[model samples]
Target: MEQHKYSISKWCTVSEEVVKRFDQVVFEGEKGDFVAFAKAYYKTNEIDYPKFFKMDALSKLAFIGSECLLMDEEFDKPTSDIALLFSNASSSLDTDLKHCESIIDKDSFYPSPAVFVYTLANICLAEVSIKHKLQSENAFFVTPSFDGDLMYTQVKYILETHRAKQVLCAWVEYLEGKYKFFGYMVGSYRQGELEHTRENIKEIYRR
Candidate 1:
């Protein structure tokens, strides 16, 4: 298997001031529009509301990771063989709860098929591709817990045998109105350049 260039960023950062323990995290804003949610949480010069480019924490992870890849002036738009390999601990728990709530609210039993589709964690990647026009193979991995070794191996195989030029990978887990997004912008250019060790990933999430 080949290696790739990797860059990472963590957001919706919880303040270390008011809280001492880091087991649980809290968001700074309530849900309305996620791009606006992102704007309120992180600072970036490329952001414009109309651009409304990145929505949801998972999308935000891809947006920031994509920015890192697009940074190389020599690189061009990824044409094909781009794969989205992602792993999550909670596995769309937030969206699942939303779907359940919609059907179980008693007063409102209508289930919009659209919302139901997004209830899958894989929808995050689909949304990213639609937002950025990436027509490539994609996959989502759900695990009982975070395992960096498993994620790294999946990405490597995807790139080698699956012919994926890039793997926008992340550990995005959401639960109880809380979310944490940690993405590694992995690709052909930065092969063997990243330390995808368990400790490193744990550090990424401050876990």
Candidate 2:
């Protein structure tokens, strides 16, 4: 059996203070909350996607990360050939808390359907898929923390099994006012400077 190899072609990281693409700092946020930072990023990049304002924090974090990763690449492959796999520690807790607050009081029991829709962590994956028109295998996991081993194993399995030709894997988390997003694109061909491995992912994330 031939061993399959994959490379991380591009990667992006977004936090409350900075957004980085690969090893370069693409965007930096001023002193403000996560929401304000996200808005500033959107405006600075001139992203015209109006739906961005309506997405939950988790989705917004993932969206911005993905945007930075794909900014310089051309997507000519079939939409179904690309997969999305994302993990987060908080899962959708931030939005869930908001939802809970909306329905906490009986007298002011007003559940927002919009907020209710984002209670699931996988909704972030849906938002990315919808934006990029990706229709491949996608999954969202809630790990206690960043697990590079799990991400590498899953990406390898998908590629070896011919489930997808490319994958967008990420660890995006948003809770309270803190946020962190790290995403990378992987493929069988060597289009990146670094190999796709557990240690490499962990090292890059830590940087």
Candidate 3:
């Protein structure tokens, strides 16, 4: 058996602070609820996408994380050749609760199409794909926790099997009023890149 090495071209973490490539403090805003933080991050950063406001909390987190992860990185392949692999524990529970509440009261049941559309966790993947114009393979998983082996294996397979030239991996989880997003890019080796391994993935997630 042999192992193939891939590089983590870049990564981003969005929580109380926005850290890019591990330690660079790109933006740090006042601590607040997820909704407030998302709004402040988007507005303060001047991300020119008005559609962001329409997305659900999970999608919004994924969108913002993807935005910071893919910033200024040139891809060698077309957008269609990039694959998205995202996993989270909450699995869109935040939006699911909203949708559930809408239908729970039959007397006043009025489901908004907007709210119903984001019931699935994978919808966040779609939101990111649409925003970045990525037409490549994308999948989302719900795990008990952030599985580093899952992230490493899935990303490695995507690269080795030629399903994509580059793979964007993320662990975007949002439930209730808490959120954490960790995203990274895995691809062929490049200068100053971190090797894509299970340990590395866990380390980055912890950071």
Backbone collisions counted per model: 6, 0, 0
Per-residue C-alpha lDDT of model 3 across residues 1-207, encoded as one tens digit per residue: 545468888888877645355657787767766777788889987888888999998898898888887767565554877899999998988998999988898799899999999989999888888777788999998999989999888988888899998898989999887888889989998767888778888887887
Task: Tally clashes: model 3.
Answer: 0
What are the lDDT figures for the candidates, one per model?
A: 0.55, 0.87, 0.84
Q: How much lDDT does candidate 2 score?
A: 0.87
lDDT of 1 by residue, 54-154 (tens): 24445454444444333342334544555667677777776677778789977878987755766677877776565456778777788877677777777
Candidate 3: 10-residue stretch with minimal lDDT: 15-24
Estimate candidate 1's RMSD in Å: 6.5
Tens-digit lDDT string for candidate 2 (1-207): 533378888888998579988768988888657778889999999988899999998899998998887666566654778889999999999999999999999999999999999999999888888777778899898999999999999999998899999888999999988888999989976753578878889999998
Instruction: Tell me, by TM-score, which candidate is best.
Output: 2
lDDT score at residue 26, model 2, on the 0-100 scale: 87
Candidate 2: how many backbone clashes? 0
Cα distance off (Å), candidate 2, residue 164: 1.5
- Give the poorly placed runs of model 3, Cα more than 4 Å off: 1-4, 17-20, 74-78
